[model samples]
Target: MRNPLDENKLEGHLRSVAAAGCQITLQDLEGYRPQTQPSTTSLEYESQYKLLVQRLVRSFSLEQLTQVLELYHLQPPPKPTKRKCARSIVEQEWNWPSLADVRRKKIDSEFSSQTFPLARHVSFLLLGKDGSQLRQLSLRHNVHVSFSDRPLSLKAEGLSGSLRLLEQDVKDFMAGITQETFALPVKRTISLASIQHISRTSGAFLETVDSQKLRIFYNKSHPHTLVLAKELIMQGLCQVTNLYI
Candidate 1:
């Protein structure tokens, strides 16, 4: 049997029930505005839902829930943040092949040539104080090189050295430093023409290449990379760093 109530009357009945049993207020259904930027309908829906949930408690049924939510218009899920893989970091950190190493080796292979030779790059197999091997550079050119002696250093993964961090870390660490452009073979390693082992009393020294953000950590008489870089900058070397490019 059809009841005599009109559609408006039925809506009013539903609204009254929702008002009593749930938190759908006139404000909830109609929304709000202020002096600032106009709020989106989505926000209004969220606010309404919050009000409804708090008001409804355990009384909200599936059908009632669907009716209220149909107007809300939910947003899509946010995109995921892509993290740099640590292996790539390790490879970049160490696998940086050096052109200078090649130049040095070439000099070693040949005899005296009147031509002034330059050290383009170097890669060292650093042995521990013990006879045991510690690390090996896959390559090192104008850039820094980090290599581990473990057989893993030569993997398709880009030099996977054993008991050592991955190459990606090395790369990322390098990424931290901004490279200065020189006329050289653009983007090539600078070789140390010579190494005179000069040992003396203490002052300061380079702790590590990557931890150079702290300005307070520099001591002049003591030689650290950042300090050396600072001195070089004073002497007209471009100082590029994670903090300053």
Candidate 2:
């Protein structure tokens, strides 16, 4: 016997079930057995199926929709687009808190260079004291103290190399010291000829040099070593562009 119901009629049945709030399950539908009419084309069957789905959606409540979607493992509809807020638009326009601004804020801390005094850019090293093995003196220029195996080494990392003298020199200077402290004045004046000679010999371009102030830090009352350092300064052995104690 030929099946009498077509795809359209089956769609109508589905709409009626949904409108009456009559719940239907997959098992019930499978048992009911939808029958296509003998005259129904393949395209017509597909169209009717789509219409059935659309009508069912329009008639079902939120709860029914949720249950149906869950039963079928279907994805929910996409969320609606959100409207732009005034503050967000303003922030986009201003573009504050840039990378540089953030970095500056972070670096501008209590221990920043601006808060601390300016020190000379020099190397720091730890070596032995006693002034023995003078070759061990080859250290980073910024080192003021000795950190070595020698127990006699003084902790003078805070002092400058200009203030340091050889052990023999210190001994000789100490012999004549009656006062507590001694000061040696160095002349700031440098002749143009001397500058040219230094530039040629040391391969230092004088034109790019900024400040040339001679600075010396040494032990107080060490007159012998002080005079020796002063003579070296006079002879242009080392150029103190900027000296800081």
Candidate 3:
């Protein structure tokens, strides 16, 4: 007998089940079953199955979506956009109830949490100017990291092993950063050029500010190189000042 539920009704029911955190079953998609008549091709059944899975996957949160992908041992794209990740998950041959059971067990049994106190500058660096680094770290570690601005800390939750590795990565990153700001005189073209040269030669990052100042971030281990860069900027500024006199 043909199931009474259409694709739209089945999708609505699945969305409610997901929101309610209920395990999904093939029975829940009774409406999506192929008709009993001879006109329904096997290819039609396959297409309907894929379409239902795609819609179901979209209802999951990004975190849950990733967990589902991981549960199936599916590799997401390098960029891991939500649409791409969902498409990858939909391609997997999943027994929904079994997959959900394994995902729940894995999360409950192996997960741990940690918080790191971050210096303002360290947080700034880890988050990147655009927050791309933080996103990358979250995906790479398979961990969720939340940052607090007032207290300036990061709270991370993931599998215990991944959490340990993420902690080490954060520490190693913090150890390497050395940030300094330089104030420039009104006529700073010469000083800016000198600073740029120092940045390229020493492999430092520079953040220019309103033509009046700049900030440089480099490894703290290279104190001597930083001293030389500062001297070069000052010397260039002095030369420019003398020329205008």
The lDDT leader among the candidates is: 3
What is the Cα root-mean-square deviation between model 3 and the actual structure? Answer: 17.6
Candidate 2 residue-wise lDDT, 1-245, digit = tens: 32446544655675577677777665533333333321122335444443433444544444455454445555444441111111111113222223333444444322311011111111111111233323344343233334332433333332322223333333443343332121224535555676444433332223212244533333343344445534544566335445522
Give residue 34's lDDT in candidate 1 (0 to 100): 17
Candidate with the greatest TM-score versus the true structure: 3
Using TM-score as the measure, what is the rank order of every candidate, best first?
3, 2, 1
Q: On a 0 to 100 scale, what is the lDDT of residue 157 in model 1?
A: 24
Off by over 4 Å in 3: 1-109, 187-215, 218-245
Clashes found in each candidate (C-alpha, N, C closer than 3 A): 40, 8, 0
Prediction 2 TM-score vs. true: 0.21
Q: Which of 1 and 2 is the better model by lDDT?
A: 2
- The TM-score values for the models, in the order shown, are 0.18, 0.21, 0.35
Alpha-carbon RMSD to native, per candidate: 23.5, 26.2, 17.6
The digit string of per-residue lDDT tens for model 3 on 1-245 reads 53446556666765776788765443553334334422122335445545545665655555555665666567866887656666565445343223344445555558799899997657766776467778988998999999987788999999877887898889888888987887875565644556556665545555676577777776676566567657767777788788888
Clashing pairs in 2: 123-142, 144-156, 144-157, 145-156, 145-157, 163-217, 163-218, 182-221
